[model samples]
Target: MGKILVIADQKDSAIATGRGLELAARLGYSVDVYAFVYAPLGRLKQTAAERNALKQRLLEDREAEVQARIDKLSREGQKVKLKVVWQKDVAPWVVGHCGKTAYEMVVKTGRRSESIANTSTDWQLLRECPAPVLIVAKKKWRRTQPVMAALDLSSRIAAKKQLNATILSQAIALAEAMDEQLHIICAVEVPTLLEDLDLIDSRSYVAEAKQAMAPHIKALARQFDLPLKAFVVKRGPVEKVITSQAASMRAQMVVMGTVGRKGVRAKLIGNTAERVLGQLKTDVLALKP
Candidate 1:
């Protein structure tokens, strides 16, 4: 694995450094902490212009606070090198910076009070960044906790197969690194259109979905050397089923995937990944293929 780009958003919420650092240590990935200051200088146009020294002092103070947070985490015996970058316009900057390096993953605190109309920087990065993203939760978890991997066997796109594999592989690796159990789940829900289309049977579709996912689940189990019991198949909208599965299993983290590049229905429909994220209270490791 390469270095991980950690977006330290102290302003949004307390940086969940423990989970991020633990993940980096397990993956053996160096951490580059990017702490962006959102507060404009002096918070007033006239004050910023007249009180240049005061503005400078404020900027320095803000940077110091962020640096202090990073320093505190770095000292806790994490075997990862840590570096920091401070700037403004954090989200767009981070998205652009992703193209400059081959970072294995981008870790950040999940956006606060997020909604369709009010999406946050983390959501933007999840949609745009080239690297995989790990949205750490405010609630901390033990170093070793169960993780659930969400699988969608009904995707028609050829690339979805690659995405599923990437999701499972990372989840498996993390489970091994932390000495935690990895649960694989396939959530199937018949779409509303299924009833409208001719020759479409909801019950039969559910059965076929399970049948289709069986081989892939079995293959992943063998590859990861996981027991058959680790795999599960659920029926419901992913927003409900994925979270329900994770909660039931007491998973501290969930590894899933999103479509990075836009597609035909991308504009018309909200990302299912976002819906799942909204429902879960645990940390999420998102990947793109």
Candidate 2:
């Protein structure tokens, strides 16, 4: 199996690393822990060489500290590697590394901001990282909890269709590996503006939306060999419905896809994955189409 890349933060608690190690141990994959560290800037009068020396010392210290923690937390007989890079921001480095390395997945702790307008490192990685990114939460996985896969069945776009398949495929693999149940979640988005203007009836619109999503949902369940009872179709905002269902079901993780929006488009439209992630208390496995 390929290695799983776990991004370590400067925080005392290595939540991502621990979760990644557990996942790796379960899936039989090795782990590569990358700890990005930075030293305080030297005084303006300080020589360049002195500043460089300080940075190197800081990197070495962080390396040792991370290594000790990894040694303590890593599973026995697991092939885990550690690399401490002297960089404060990790998104760029991790995105570049994923391009060069054949990691099965990239695991990182979700650093969410209060507002979706403000982007976090997880948002950056979700957009640019080539490999599948798993943003773990504070809550650990429970064996009985289901692994929920979110799909946009209303979208007829080829990319969305492909992404739905990818999301289900990953979720199925995870559920099987962890011996957990697999659940499917799709939100029926009713147009609020049209309904408000009396252009469309709210109840009829909801019925039509659910009806439109039926065949696709059935095909997916058959394709994945999942029972119909495991599927959840709800009406509301995508973010609200997914988060609510995950909470209600006590999902271990929610697997979904992001189109990898960038720049102004990302900020303006606000990626669904980003918004849902802001509210999710469970782990998320985000894939790119």
lDDT of 2 by residue, 1-289 (tens): 7799999856588888888998899889999999988756755568899888888888889888888889889978999998888776788989998999888899998877735466688999999999999998865436428889999898989888989988999899888898998888888877889878899888888898888888888888899887878778889988899999988888989999888999988888878888888788888888988
Question: How much lDDT does each candidate structure score?
Answer: 0.74, 0.86
lDDT of 1 by residue, 1-289 (tens): 5687777666535455656666777777777766654445555666545767755666677667766666666646654543444466676788888888888888888763464355577777878888888887775434436978887777767788778878888888888888888888888887877667755888898898888878877876787677878778888888788888887777888999887534334435767677777777788888887
lDDT, residue 173, candidate 1: 84
Q: What local lDDT does model 1 show for residue 282?
A: 80
Model 2 is weakest, by summed lDDT over 10 consecutive residues, at 136-145
Candidate 2 C-alpha error for residue 185, in Å? 0.8
The candidate 1 region of ten consecutive residues with least summed lDDT is 259-268
| lDDT score of residue 104 within candidate 1 | 80
Residue 174 Cα positional deviation in candidate 2, in Å, after optimal superposition: 1.0
Candidate 1 local Cα displacement, residue 190, angstroms: 1.3
Q: Where in model 1 is the C-alpha error above 4 Å?
A: 11-13, 38-55, 75-87, 115-117, 139-144, 196-200, 261-268
Off by over 4 Å in 2: 40-49, 114-118, 139-144
